[model samples]
Target: MKFPKVQLALVQMRDAGSKTASIAAATTWIERAAAEGAQVICLQELFATCYPCQAEDHTMFDLAESIPGPTTDALAELARRLEVVIVCPMFEKRAAGVYHNTVAVLDADGTIAGIYRKMHIPDDPLYYEKFYFTPGDAGQPRASVGPDKPNGFNVISTRYAKLGVGICWDQWYPEAARLFALAGADILLYPTAIGWIDEEKEEFGAGQLDAWMTSMRAHAIANGIFVGAPNRVGIEGRVEFWGNSFIVSPRGEVIAKANSADDAIVTAECSLEEMDVVRTHWPFLRDRRVDAYGDLTRRFID
Candidate 1:
């Protein structure tokens, strides 16, 4: 299959005090990226609001909005005007007392293409995502929205690219990346909001950051697809958000990376044709022993 070279952009920035401010700032960055020739752009997770996963508060539920609500509406219009594919993460209010960490993909025409609800909800010390999000169900391949296909991961097709979007925690799981790649996603986009806990920084900051970047790069190399991660920056409460947003090519090369201290937008041209060459040379998928991998389904081999 022939693919065109696309300019991928990631907007890495600290959250402004207000939603209006954050969105406005993101708009400016998006415009800048477009002006610089970016065809596909991704914003940090929950760009419209602060990282609410910092704590489990009832008020945070109010921040969740419908997928086609005001936020998506505005973004759709902006995407159409800019003629760029946008992968935007948000706190989704599916219904009363029901919500999910979802990212909606907007096509170049400014239409709602599809949504990918976070499948993994982590409940660590400061990150309380499980408290707010209902895990998405990934059922049979290409299943409908019925009970069988509750949390279907959608690979949105747009004029610029086929996007496979996952939230922060989802980036750690290779299964998600593989599934998306198998489903024909040319680019894997992870809109993230991750940082160092002040207390842990002195001990594990460097290692954690290395592991984070290493894991994402592995996904790009193994899947033979472009990986784009747009992370939040600045200190918010006990968490000092590490910025370093980046884009990695199929060969696991870091095409562009942002600084760890400030608001930035970085863009790079991703050669989609390289994926075929890399995969052909690597041939990991072609050599996979699928029949012998049943143990992967078990909780513990023991």
Candidate 2:
């Protein structure tokens, strides 16, 4: 195996009031994670800001910055110095009226390897993403993975491993997971910020968290790949960010997990060799009928 075993880590943190403070806190976490022997690290979605899409307020655009702006510059220098690959998700200000929920992969050498825009925008009660982010449509018809493929589902080759990264809402889609895995991603990473709203906690909290975990684990099992989720914790506005950060093996077993409400770093040693073993045994990819799934692209069959 090219990579025998890679140490993956996730920084699960809460909003530190301001974006600058959050970036500073994230920097501390990245250094700490690297000191703990992490080769690849992923921070929760929008690590440099509070979950700003809670409302469609026009002022939220002030939080957005270009990719090479302060956040990525700081992270890139840190990545080069620490020699660790860091997945940094940010609110991207692409143009005057254009923005995206994007993840910039900083390679070990500090280069921006690639970026994946969040595709599946959810317009739930507090999770108002559609108003803030344009659905990712900046690439050509895809047959493989690259920066030029579908702007959403991309497998970025890093120094430690090829990372298939998806944002919060994208985590629930099995199709996205399959495409990432097929594109030769070694481990799938989903940086998220999800929790129960103050109103929905009583009736829908536990089930919601359960489904969040189940869906990601199923992706690992179905695709014969490792999966990692790093979620935020503590209360932010009306929502309490449940920090159930975790890592799962190819067999869908939780190897490492954090509590629902703790500032923690969830770390796991993933074996690239195990990916080969599991894929050979399960062979789900070998049996896929790719020729018959064309209808998947349609919005409705009827």
Candidate 3:
């Protein structure tokens, strides 16, 4: 089936200290993207505020807000006015003590379409996410299973296509991408805020960025689907986010790429027709031996 060509805009921005600055910067970028004929737009992870996971200070919890809070309300209105789908990532305070790294998908009509929480939480030097967010229960393929429930990925259908939303750490796992593809996702969207630490920038920065981009591209090629990664740029606290945001086509070719340290809107035209063509020629999904992969359920087979 020949699908309509969809234009996507990825907004890569510097970490703005306050929500006011962040919203203003995002609004400006969204207007620019609309003028360029973008139907779907995505912002970087934790775009509303600076990367708060840099430290485990309890005061950082003040940044968290309800899903339908002011940020989403404003973005929804913007989506309606522009007639575009907006993926807004925010620090979500789910309940009294529960919090999450969540992305809210606002439809063209300005309605809240769906929300996907970041299933994978990374606990590294500058990234102390485990101190703030509770790991999402979205049931990715690698999720630990309980005796009563089975784990599977979540694929949300939009007007344009079926979207599988994954945050930064989730993008590193091929299993996450493959499970989403198996669940019939046409595209995988990753909202990220990744960067180099103070000292590691000189030693491991280049390799880290390369691995990040290459992994996502490999996911696109392996799944025969489009992959979109919108990452933030600029220095925030001790970490400097490397802003190499890009969109990879079904054939694993980068159609659009942003700079490594700039606040720019990267647009890409995705052709869904290529998905059918590519998957037909390379039938990896068809040859999968599901019965032989039971070992995947274990953390590590010794």
Candidate 4:
């Protein structure tokens, strides 16, 4: 269970106004990550398209594409050529009207490893995900309250590492991270598109970003696994997407971090031995109270 040292890369970039432009920009970044010796690379959520969930527009449904559609086809070729693991998030067109916010993991050989649909759909202001996406399977009733799917918190095994993929809102939930850790994921990758709504920037921006990062860092500390999050980095509409994408070690140490307002590629060398050391010292998983957490399934503990 010893993972070798891995050069993890987070491609943090701004949207280029159009899907074609965005894809091209991401392609360049991916190539850059590979050239810099990043064995595993993850792009921001919806890298092919700008953040379109700002408002519930019926036309936005056009953005959804099949899992093996054009985007993955292009990424697959790139992954094969570079021989690097790629984690790509896209708006999926499951059926006619059904869509899910999912990330398709491409193995180093360019094969589709698996897709993790966003389990927790947030419905807050400026982030109307429920309007467009259906939540992914959360296992039976007790494991999760979301709709059931055959793939529940799947951990994909690629040539480089076993990745537990999660989307933006999923990062806010500890259950998502714990499930991945327990399932033997070497690292947790969150492809996110979160930002500050223009109106709330002055008051809650700093706190919001701190909470977002703190939660993910806590996951790394608790699970004793690497955590890599690549976030969008520009103002699309009302929200200014905070870039600050980063990688953290098992002990919650910041390995590499991007600037808050810049398009950059952040890379860090993470040692698998560090994970074992941290987990041995702080054996939280070994002392979990699993038998007493049955009520976690209830809607409210009333």
TM-score for all predictions? Answer: 0.96, 0.96, 0.94, 0.95
TM-score ranking, best first: 2, 1, 4, 3
For all candidates in order, the CA lDDT equals 0.88, 0.91, 0.87, 0.88
Q: Write the per-residue lDDT of candidate 2 for residues 1-302, one digit (tens) a residue.
A: 26789999999999999988998999999999999999999999998888987888999999999978899999999999999999999999888999998899999999988888888899999899999998775465555545434355768998889999999999999999998999899999999989999988999999999999999999999999999999999898899998999999999999999998778899999999999899999999999998999999999999
The per-residue C-alpha lDDT of model 1 at residue 77 equals 92
TM-score of structure candidate 3: 0.94
Q: Give one digit per residue, the lDDT tens place, for model 3 in 1-302.
A: 22478888899999777999999889999999999999889899999999998888999999999978899999999999998889899999989999999888888888877778888899999999999999877434434432112233577556666778899999999999998899888889999999999899899989999999999999999999999999999998888899999999998999999998789998988887888899999998888899999999899989
lDDT of 3: 0.87
| Regions of model 3 farther than 4 Å from truth | 1-3, 139-152
List runs of model 1 lying over 4 Å from the truth. 1-3, 140-151
Instruction: Itemize residue pairs with steric clashes in candidate 1.
Output: 137-151
The true-structure Cα RMSD of candidate 3 reads 3.7
Alpha-carbon shift of residue 235 in model 3 (angstroms): 0.6
Single out the weakest 10-residue window by summed lDDT for candidate 4.
141-150
Give the Å error, residue 45, model 1: 0.7
Predicted structure 4: clash tally: 0
